[model samples]
Target chain A: MRRLWIGLTYAVFALLIVVPLVKIATGSLEDGVSGLLDALLRPEALHALMMTGIIVVFVTLINTVFGVMLAIYLVRAAWLHPRIKGLLNSIVDLPYAVSPVIGGLMIVLLVGPDTALGALLEGAGIKIVYALPGMVIATLFVTFPLMVREVMPVLQEIGSQQEEAATMLGAYSWYTFWKVTWPSIRWGVIYGVVLTVARTLGEFGAVLVVSGNIMNLTQTATTLVYQDVENFNVVAANGVALVLAAFSVGLLLLMEWAKKRKEVH
Target chain B: MHIEVKGLSKSFGDFKAVQDVSFGIKKGHLIGLLGPSGGGKTSILRMLAGLEAPTAGDILFHGKRVNDLPPQERGIGFVFQNYALFKHMTVFENVAFGLKVKKLPKDAIRERVQSLIELTGLKGFEHRYPAQLSGGQRQRVAFARALAPEPQLLLLDEPFAAIDAKIRSELRTWLKEMIERVGITSIFVTHDQDEAIEVADEIMIISKGRLEQKGTPWEIYKNPETQFVAEFIGESTTVDNVAALHGFEEAAAWTGTRGLIRPEYIEIGKPGEITLASATMRGVVRHIHFRGSEWMVELEIGDIRLITYRSLEKDVLKPGDPVDILIHRAYLFNESDSWIMENKLKVDPMPVII
Candidate 1:
């Protein structure tokens, strides 16, 4: 009975996820291979690819640096009160709960031209809202929690014992981190980075609202797919959508490979 | 190097784990900090290792103060009770960790690691991770790691507690021999009196976060300063109204109470006039346990119960047999019941006139 239940659950999961992918593949194949390739390699499609890649790279880099530091601080620092720690931890998790569009709106409200900081920046000829910087901010906000969540549990499990041991063996704090702490969590950090990249690449709602879907500049692959589909350019939209899907799948595969390697090691 | 711990104290919130612990360890001696769990032996060792700071007082190593130094800078080696080896590192790398951290050349590190591996009998297992080793092997690895740095002092915190009972005895012997070979001043913590006796040059018995007694193992076993230490160190039988016994007049005068006797010193079926005066009750044998060369007999002396050891070849007494017991060489105490004095042996040592 248990095996039957498991099989049924897996069958349902495969149907839910794989059927649409199979349909998309068949529809893309209905067009000739050269036509599909031409549609995918169009200048507008290349612009969308470049824009999404830039956003993902920006978000992933910022998240990795800040997330690792945040995780280390949360685990090692005692100056922060427990309530403050909880508040900060929950704030990191806010992006997951808030809708991506809502996240974009929050960023706009805080950094838009009307706000004090936004006005100050705007006075210096630095445009943020409805621009590349705004899109980066939105993507960062939506993907901020991934790296922290992945790295924090691993750090907590490794605990302070190894660090203390390293220190006792004459390694200073920085040396101990470099020698002992970093090696233990490197795989988990890599896994988190992959997830963050995948999320940032696929992000559309927040990026669309923040960047105003500016063609050839701010329009990401996801946003361009939305535009193509809306304009009834189904083949071009599907081709770009396939590339986005393929990149996300590649990232997922990378994450799973890292996870398996960690388990085996 | 000699270590002098002066009035060291540590408290965790409201509970004082170690209080006013002051002791000096002479150079080139293996000292055992003996205590039951929660008796602050580990805390004292931690303070010595500079893993923890005393809430009060200071520590001096070789007459130089080092209370504020970090563990690595203290030039002290520490072996944790769990043998905290790095799970990912092989035995050779684990031992070489300290050398590498010291920024030694690669060839020097390799030579030192190889020497330590050979010394620890881990030559064949040098490439094996800690997870792949047994508890005793892991303990040896921890010892090697601590010793590779060639620190002036070494601290072992219950090093053999995690090993199997059979291996623990062998490890204790090996550890004592190893410490003697290296001749580095060492301190090991243990609750097992037998382990302390077998390994330590001097044993410091602690109770309730305070030092109860500090002496050689023989002195601790034969002349415990407190009832807690006496009971903790070995098997002892308390005699009620011991003041009435022979040679106990001065003891009775001081204590106004009874005294205790170790089981090994007690003899059955014999008593002198004054010794008879202390013989308050006759006992019936409850059971007899043959222990290799000696027999341990449990006796029911009226409502009280006592155990005494006799030679295996002595007259065998069964359950319900009546017997007379005497306190041959007993320890006397003061009014506080703290050990005041001990009865001296009367026999002279045989002369070796070669």
Candidate 2:
């Protein structure tokens, strides 16, 4: 009976997930090599892929640094009251609870031309909404919690004993953090960065709202695929989707490796 | 260097962990900070290591105030209870960490680390990570790492609390030998009285964040100044119980004061010779248990009871056997936790008053 139940679950998973992925893979190559090349090699699609790549890299870098700092503060700052610490801990996971569309709308409200923050930046000739800056911010807003959540647990588990030991051994605060604390949590940081990258690559709703889906200026790969499907260009859409799936698979492997490394420690 | 702590106190919010604790550690002595759990021994050790800032008072090292110095600047080696060796580094690297941070020459760091490892008996385990070592080996690594910087003073917080029972005593002896070889002034905290008595050159007993007493092991055991110390340092019973059993009304006046008598001082006498010649009070053996090479006999005199230790080779005394016990010696303390006088009385069945 247990085997039958497990088989039924696998069948459902296969029908819902594996079947569509297989169909997309086969359908993308339906037009043969040249046709597939033509779809992916189009100037607009190439530009869109490059835009997506740039935004993902920028978001991953910014979020990784900020996420690690936030996690360390949450774990190590002794002066924070319990209530305030709990509030901040919950807010770190705000991105996970809030929808991406709402996250994008939040950025739009803060940086659109009509708002004070947006008008002031515009006067300085800094473009946010409908540009690369706005797209990166939107993606970051949705993926901010991934890295912090991953690193915070590891930091909490390792505790401050080793750090204190280093300080007692004539190590300053910076040296202690670098030599003792960082080594213990590096795998967690790597895992978090990869998760953020994976999430940024697939981000659509927030980027769509903030980037305005500008054809050549801020049209990321996801928006490009959406636009292609709207125009009944199924071949182009499938090609882009297949490339994203491959990147996601690579990211999944990296995340798995990171998790394994953490367990060994 | 000799160290002196004057009026040191630490408070967390509203709770005072260490309050007005003052004591001096002489140069080149292995001192034990003995206390019960939550007795603030660790807090005092942390203050000495500069890991904790006392809420008030001064900490002096060789007459130089170090209250404002950070832990790294204090030049003290601190070993934590859990043997917090760097998990990511090998034993060699862990020991060399401080020297490397100081930017010592490569050869100097290597030579210092190798010697310290050998001193701590971790010579062959230099390449092993902390996780790969046994509990005792890990403690050795922690000790080696703490000593690598050639610190002025060494502080350890319950270093043997994590070791297995079978190896704990061996490690304690080894640790004492190692510290003597290093010849640095050191302080370690422990809750185990036996470990403190066995390993410490001088013991400072603390309770409720206050220093109860400080003296050599024999001094502290034989001449405990406070009621807390007398009860905490060794196995003993109150003198009031002995006085009450013998109907000494004057001795009852010492109640709410201090008086202690050790179990080993009292001995079993023949019940048939019940005269006042050699027995203070007569009682029946209530219980008996073989304790190592000795028999722990409990005696009941009316409603009062006393415990005594006798050699197992002595004639076996069974429960319900009436026996007379002789009171050998007892110490009395005043309200200030100071010894008032020693009352050495000859055992006699009389209403003897002190």
Candidate 3:
């Protein structure tokens, strides 16, 4: 019975993942290796890939710091009123509930050029609407929950006993965190970081809507692939999509590896 | 260090965990906060360790009020019920944590940790992580870690609760002796009266967030000041009435409303086997439970049932056998006070006033 179920699952996996991946790989090589290289090395493709890299690094860094802190606050801060803590917990998960396009729209609505905050920032020489800053903020809004969600369960599982033991032994709060709390939660934080990196790298709808898909200014890799398909450049689109798929596959493997490490602990 | 807590109380919202509890610990004495589960023994320990803020109280260490001191500033050692060893760190690193926090020289830290490892009998297990150690070993690591900084007082919460039955007794004796050798004022919480009686120099009985009685285990065992203490400190069962029992006429003046008796205080034997068989009451054995080294015989005398232990040397008792029962003494208590009621035949009979 188990074997039959496993075979059926493999069949579905092939149709959904294996076949499309093979098709993308073949399609990207349609003009041969040189043609594929030429399309990928094009100035616009290079710029979009660079934009995606920058966003992934910044978003992961910001998300990891705030996310771990928020998770700790949510789980350990006894002084917080339960209702307010519950509300904040749901707010952390808001990114998962709202559509990425709507998240992008919300960010633009709140901080677009014509909005008061946006106008003030723009007057202070900060262009946010069709710029890298807006792309980062929109992506941040969409992927805000990943790290916090990963770390919260871990913090809860380990409980506050060891931390209390550390403090009772005359460890300052920071030292207790680094010595007792951090080591236990490091795997959880790493798993969250991997998830955040993957999500940031592949973010599309929000980045496209917020970045405005300007040629070289804020056009991320996914946005550029959309523009390629829109302009009847299927070969270039396939090349960019192939790269994104490969990156996603690598991230998936990294996530699995991180998960195994976490379980071992 | 001499420790004093003046009206320390703790509440979790509507639930009062520790209420208006106050006690003192003489220097270098081992104390046990003994109580039933959910009876607020651990809450008092946490407050003493500075891990929980008291709702209203003054905690003094060597005559200085430490109510505002953070746990780090309090310089106390705490062993949690679960041990709470750092899973990621080796036993050596776990013990060396507080020393490293003090930024001591590496050699000093190594020497101290090494000595503690030997002291805890975990010499070869130093490199192993907490996951690799047994429950008893993990408990030792917790003890070593807490003692690393040589804190003023050590607080342990239910120290032997996580261990299985066999090793628990062994660890209890080991912990009691280790605390004596170190001679640091220590307080441990336990629901197990045996653990407290066997381990602590002084035992404080707590119930419903209030201090019931505080004394040497012998004092609490022989002369419980409150009904709760008399009922809680041992395997005591409440006797319905003391005046109806054989040779207990003096109990009438005591108004023994809630009479409590310990199994060891009640003697059960074949009619002539009991020394004062003439003054003994008649009871039929109801059930016999094997208690490892002794037999716990349940007996029914008139309207009430009693429990008494028979040594393995005694002839086996059957369920329906009639036996002579001479209760040596029992505790009698009313709402406001309690007193010990002796068997009138064993002591000089006093004139009953009531």
Standalone chain B TM-score for every prediction: 0.89, 0.92, 0.92
Candidates in order, TM-scores: namely 0.87, 0.95, 0.93
**If ranked by TM-score, best first, what sequence of candidates would result?**
2, 3, 1
* lDDT (Cα, tens digit) per residue for candidate 1, span A60-149: 889999999999998777568778998998898989999999999888898888899999999999989878899999999899999999
Model 3's DockQ score: 0.79
Interface RMSD of 3: 1.0
Q: How do the residues B50-162 of candidate 1 rate in per-residue lDDT, one tens digit apiece?
A: 87778998999988899978887988778888887876788888898888899999999999989888998988999999889999999999999888888899999998889
Tens digits of per-residue lDDT for model 3, B1-354: 999989988999999988999888899999998998999988888888777889998999999999888888888898999998888889999999889888899999999999999999998998999999999999999999999999888889989999999999999999988999998999999988889899989999999999989999999988888888888877888876777888776666755366888998899898678766556888999999998999989999988888988999979989999899998888887777778877878653454568
lDDT of 2 by residue, A1-265 (tens): 9999999999999999899889878878989877778889999889999999999889999999999999999998877887899999999889889999999999999999889999999999999998999999999999999999999999999988999999998899888888998889999999999999999989999999999998877999999999999999988889989999899999999999999998887
TM-score of chain A of 1: 0.93
Better of 1 and 2 by DockQ: 2
**Which candidate leads in TM-score?**
2
How far residue A174's Cα lies from its native spot in candidate 2, in Å, is 2.6
Give, for candidate 2 chain B, the lowest lDDT window spanning 10 residues. Answer: B340-349
Q: Which candidate model has the greater DockQ, 1 or 3?
A: 3
What is the lDDT ranking, best to worst? 3, 2, 1
Error of 3 at B303 (Å): 1.5
